[model samples]
Target: MTAMALTQRPASVLSRLLHRHEACRGWLLLAPALCLMLVAILFPLGSTLVMSTWSLDGYSVDRTPTLGNYSAMLGQPMFGALIGRSLVVATIATVVTVALCYPMAYFVAFHVHRHKALWLILLTLPFWTSYLLRVFAWKVVLGYEGVLNTALIGLGIVQEPLAALLYSQTAVTLVLAHSWAAFAILPIYVSLEKIDRSYIEAAADLGDGLTRRFWRITFPLSLPGVVAAFFMMFVPTVGDYITPAMVGGPDGMMVGNLIQAMFGPMNNWPAGAALSVVMMLTIGLAGLAFLAVGRLVGR
Candidate 1:
């Protein structure tokens, strides 16, 4: 093309793009992301919903859409109990993880200022390894013939191995808390670190005691991070079956194990899909309700 024509074409393209409505421009920019989300998230979710309605008939999956799966899943008291148990364990993990994480984050943010980078590296070093490996490490440490039992036995603290340490609800909670500690700590640390020192100093200057300042200013500001940490720890722990399966014994198993069993040799795909969809919807609604309550309380 001629030089003048080429320049004119470029200017025309730029001018047209620049002159577009802001909302239209924004949508155009977001189109690629919307397409990706449609394929990756919505498509699979749609498939799952469709499959949830399919009933098994002898050999083939009956394509007829029916609420049979939902009826079957909801009718069982066992499923309700398992779901409640999962929530309880997840709640315990969230609370314990946050409780332990906040103090550590506070210490790191306030006390270890000099080697902060080194401390952060050491803090996250455990995550470089496989998540299961860490859970397994805990299993070894808590086993009947493992470190805790052997140490207690050597120290004459207990007469026999502490069988209670390895395969119970306690073990599940302990392992989950430990496993997700880093997720809790990092968000809290970031929030604590971001608290402008000036606020604390100003509070102190105004005769506010440390306790008063913390309750009035620090805790409120850090709550976003705390909530983030709680959800991060809570959501996955609800669906976690690996830690329970490896260390839980029969009593410690979560709802995820039952879902897996349904999908596996049980050949109950419709029921499994229904259970998963219902659980997801329940969790989502609960999260939304929580956010609504938090917003109302804040006002």
Candidate 2:
């Protein structure tokens, strides 16, 4: 009996070892991706934080760590205004894109059967072009002597070019909205496509009107897409520098512009790094808040 029990212990120990070996293999399979993320993302982020504590000029570095940069940024009245402008532009662009894309997505999803793929292709066609070129085209169109102003003048709508039309907050919002439209449309279309057709039919059969059916059946399910679209538009717009630089007036400059200045001509690398970190944190927090709100509203 003692000999038999000793032999059984070896078998049990081997079984446990095999189980742990399988688990280790699974972890090994995931190791490459985890390593890549750490190298590509985490390393840069940690380095940036370290850099943010030290000031650097063009040719030399100041090893002294100070909160003076942050203090100066907070002291500036323009800092608050720039942050406000960025938020306003991002929010407006997100709202407009989501509202406009929903109907277009709905049409492509439910209304149009023939050439649906063609229509979707066309919708995404603009993105194939260079973003900077597209922005330049908008700049030309909104310029004082541009097509829009010329057309309006020809129609006698106005005697002169509206200087306010270009290089204004409105121009920034419009261009960003146009640029981000595809971001808004695709997700909503995907969501609407995934919804079962029978559900809509059943709601109709129950005598729910078109508006009522849409509100009850369609809208709730599409919340995920709406949330996705909002983030897609909001995140990039908040950090956008090019659009504001080209089209935005001095008054319309965003926080990204300031960060760029700190890194570039301003020669304040530490401040720029700090600002970048803060912006990332702000965006992360905002995204989490939006997700929470979306879940609550969905319920």
Candidate 3:
């Protein structure tokens, strides 16, 4: 009986300790994920930050810490321009994707009574194919003498194919918006679907019109999803090199392209790492600003 009591006493003390430290217990529950993130995310980020501080020597890494890479990045106007272009392209794509997808999500949430799953499946059908294939399709469509140009020419709208349609910032934006449409739509639909109809119905009962009810109750509640969509779209788009490489000609070349060049043909890993750090910091700051704006709007 004394032995059993002693064992139970430790168990009870442990239980009480855990109960007192709810946050500690929660962290224990999340330990696996935290460890994985520490290994995968933090380790790589720390390596990159360390690499950013190093410089390249002739045919070898100097392995000496220096701020020259960051200094050069700041002193150079070209880097700033590319980063700005990336931000603009990403921002425009995010806005266009969200704006276009919101109505579709709203329709699926509010109007689709039968086979909601089917509607969602249909909405996501375009994403079934590989991302590259979709981007290539856009390229074919936007190319000079492509389908759009051919159709317009046949309709007598123009004598020649519009060269501006492809290999431009606009082209990059269009491709990005098309690529991320599903990502923006799903979250928004989920948010709208989860909204209690009672609030909207009450607004209607109070003589509120559709727009008023949407602005007053529906939109505010869905701001979380909207904010999530914006973040998901904006972050990846800013660092997108593939779309820009394929279609973003010289004028549309972004920071991602430069970073790729630095690591690839240029073989300047340290500089690339520095640029990567700057890009990550820029995205973080932008995300914070966007989140703040979303919170303000929600209020």
Candidate 4:
């Protein structure tokens, strides 16, 4: 070959090699996260599906795959009631938390200026303690001889300790709200923080009142974070067993409590697995519905 042609061929090969190297690097960077997710999430989900098809007692796994467990779950009258109760509790808790947090988030984002960081730290400070301990603390406070009852009696607000204070749906809802309040606040605060000050100022200059400016510009823009927080709080609350078990009475027992009982006291792993699978499907559908609503509202 001619020397010039040979040199040009070498340069072309080197350029192609460098391009492939960059592409390989990008794939290598993504591989670890993909692998982690497959192992952590997808693998467990697949295993749950497989386990749901068989009977697993504490003694041994029955290799005979059957739909009997699912059928039993569906046929049980309590299953529908349990699911309905769970949805109601989670929905109410999510709504209450959002309502309470939005104003607080708005205050912290727009009203607080000098010590905003300190206030945020204070807001999140309660979560630094163990969650179980916090729940236990609430139990003490709401119990018959606890702080709230004592205060009410001492203040003459009530003649006697309110027997309905603990072990009721109301108690469960209150605790859920307390447990998940920070989850709601941070997201709404982030959304409010991202709003451009100029937009509000311009709206005011256009003779828009506070209500008009907020409705027209602020609320619409902050919606993504609100939607995100709603799901973040709702999904976990739906599956939460602790708060309900701790405070929720017989009437307040959620679907998660039943699932736990199937796994633990009942020794019915297959049933529990089926319940988990069903719950996952339910949550996935709910998420899609939420996203659709969010998009509709945003548009």
lDDT against the true structure, per candidate, is 0.87, 0.88, 0.94, 0.89
The predictions' CA RMSDs to the true structure, in order, are: 2.5, 5.9, 3.4, 4.6
Tell me the deviation in Å of residue 148 in model 1: 1.3
Each prediction's TM-score versus the true structure: 0.90, 0.87, 0.90, 0.89
Which ranges in model 1 have alpha carbons more than 4 Å from their true place? 1-15, 18-33, 292-299
RMSD in angstroms, candidate 3? Answer: 3.4
User: Could you tell me how far off, in angstroms, the CA of residue 217 lies in candidate 4 after the best superposition?
Assistant: 0.3
**Steric collisions counted per model:** 0, 0, 0, 0
Can you write out model 4's per-residue Cα lDDT over 1-299, one digit (the tens) per residue?
A: 69888777656665667677997667767999989999999999998898899986568889688987789878888887888788888889999999999999999999999999999988888798888998899999999888999999999999999878889988888899889889999999999999999999999999999999999999998998899889989999988999989988777789999999988998888889998988888888878988898889888
Q: Is candidate 3 or candidate 4 better by lDDT?
A: 3
Which candidate order results from sorting by lDDT in descending order?
Answer: 3, 4, 2, 1
Evaluate residue 5 in candidate 4 and report its C-alpha lDDT on the 0 to 100 scale: 84
* lDDT by residue for model 3 (59-149), tens: 6998889999999987889999999999999999999999999999999999999999999999998899998999999999999978999
Return model 4's CA RMSD, one decimal. 4.6
User: For candidate 1, lDDT tens digit of each residue in 129-162?
Assistant: 8989998999899998999999999999999999
Query: Which clashing pairs does model 3 show?
Result: none
Deviation in angstroms for 272 in model 3?
A: 0.5
What does candidate 2's lDDT look like per residue over 1-299, in tens digits?
99998777756665667577987667767999999999999999998887777776566778777666667668888766777778889899989989999999999999999999999999888798888988898999999999899999999999989898789988999999999899999999999999998999999999999999998999999898899999998999999998998899877789999999988998878888888877888788878988998888888
Off by over 4 Å in 2: 1-33, 56-59, 64-66
